[model samples]
Target: MADLRVLIVDDDFHVARLHATWVDAVPGFAALAPVGTAALALQAAHSLRPDLVLLDTYLPDTTGLELLRTIDTDAIMLTAASDPESVRTALRRGALGYLIKPFSADDLAAALRGYARYRRVLAGTGSLDQAGLDRARRALLGGADAPSSGGPSRSRSATETAVLEALAQGPGSARALLSAAEVAAVVGVSRATAQRYLAALAEDGAVEIQLRYGSTGRPEHRYGLSA
Candidate 1:
């Protein structure tokens, strides 16, 4: 089979570029375009007709969900919105895979491979047994639980649980989490307190942190659960 064509759409220029690079790095994939707006994305989908789309839930001009409803392409949602409701909405709206942001190259590659396998099965190229489907569903929905490498045994508080749930949706640096603030606000804590909790989780091996650098002054750190 020929390499699958991919279209990446995100309002953030950096994110769009990053996704494009990741897709290009995949052996059986080629990035057709990385667009920064819903309008452009729609146009690309109509014209380029990529095999897959990496979509973001939040956009500058329109909700990613709204754009998704209109597009005819096979889509995989890539978003920082990790809430259950959002995830449910994405899945219900026909997203093949839902990936939270700040994902590692390995995780992204895994998602792509899973989606490719799904496509093959759907196209009647391969038989999808009940067991295989079950396993794929578990992986798609983040149910393939893998234990963390190292972490303290302290029980997670309710607030901590909320924070972890948010992180599970996508990776974020402490600064980014502070900027979003929804999880912290939902859990009824100050931003400073949330940072401390993130630090603790990182220390416990519940989350992993990566240093991100750009043209900006200081390199920022992002966190995500060790999936």
Candidate 2:
């Protein structure tokens, strides 16, 4: 594939710059421009016609979700809101993926790859039948199937389901998973309880845990659906 042009929109200048730097660092992408508001983003999109957009949920002038409705390019939502409803809303609004804030470069890379793959399938560059789409959707949802079954059969509780659903939105460490605390909060539980449920899911092969080490206090453990 050719290099993808990306425009990043975030109210935080630091974040927009950081995302632009990371996207440029990636091999097959060209970070076109980084804007700080929905109005500027729309203007840039119309003028630049970027291949993709990395947009934040909150903007000084308008909500990211609303901006998404008016845009015509492939987009990914980057936000601190990890709630299932928010994630679902973003996806329903035509976003290719939902990325929570504080994501690492590797996380961004993985999402880009997924978007690339999805684009390929949509463009007929890859073969994906109904079964394949179903499997991919299940995998995206972070659901595990039984050994002999062809579909997902849940053995987790409602809390575990909520945690898994949030994790499905993007990759994150246990600490970062707190971004999705609204899931547990909606169920009326503390963040600690939500963490415990995620930990349990990790232990049960319902999720995958990865240790991320950086210039920080302790190595952070991020989780995703077990593949």
Candidate 3:
């Protein structure tokens, strides 16, 4: 299946880049260049016709809610705007998701995953039965897809999920290795906790481990997602 194309709109270049990185790290999404103004965002949306947009509530030219009213594609609000009025307006304007700022990559990944699943459920169909509609709604609201039967299943803890998402955002090259401390900072956990999760993931073949040898103390253990 083709990946979902995402256009990120935010006034802060750094925040936009971070969002793009998080969006790209998800399995079924790709992000276009970030735009800082509503005008540029509208132009890009017209030219690119992205599958979805990661929009902020604030922009240099106009409010994101205003742009959302104008755009023809789907959107998810990513902003520091915590006001209830802002949230209601974004939803009223047809935002598919709303994420407050200072969220971890894990949070964004979950939203992306949910949206992807929602799209999949509603794709290629002219009409839906009640069950189908219910499934699609559940998927859109962050419910996990039903697991396949007859296999031993182990659901990951929230911390484990966060750890995996952090690793998924790595550079994916020679320098992709991330230390436990780095993972800890990203996941908002202690280094020991991060290391424990990393070790567990490695044991489960969910991540790749590399050792960094130094002249000083012990070799530093680093991790990346398995290909």
Best-performing candidate as measured by TM-score: 3
Tens digits of per-residue lDDT for model 1 on 1-227?
A: 56689998898988788877777655456787698889899989999899999999888889888887999988998899999998888888888888887798778866775565454335555777887677556644433311211345666777678888776554354333322244466557776456545545654577665655669643444556665
Per-model CA lDDT versus the true structure: 0.69, 0.69, 0.79
Q: Over the stretch 1-227, how does candidate 2's per-residue lDDT look in tens digits?
A: 45679999999998888888777654346787699899999999999999999999999998899998999998998899788988888999998788898899868866664554444335555777896676444532343322212223545566676777666654354333433244455446676455445544553567665655679543444556787
TM-score of 3: 0.66
Please, what is the TM-score per model?
0.57, 0.57, 0.66
Order the numbered candidates by TM-score, best leading. 3, 1, 2
lDDT of 3 at 159: 85
Best by lDDT: 3
On the 0 to 100 scale, the lDDT of residue 112 in model 3 is: 81
Instruction: Count clashes in each candidate, considering only residues at least 3 apart in sequence or on different chains.
Output: 2, 3, 0
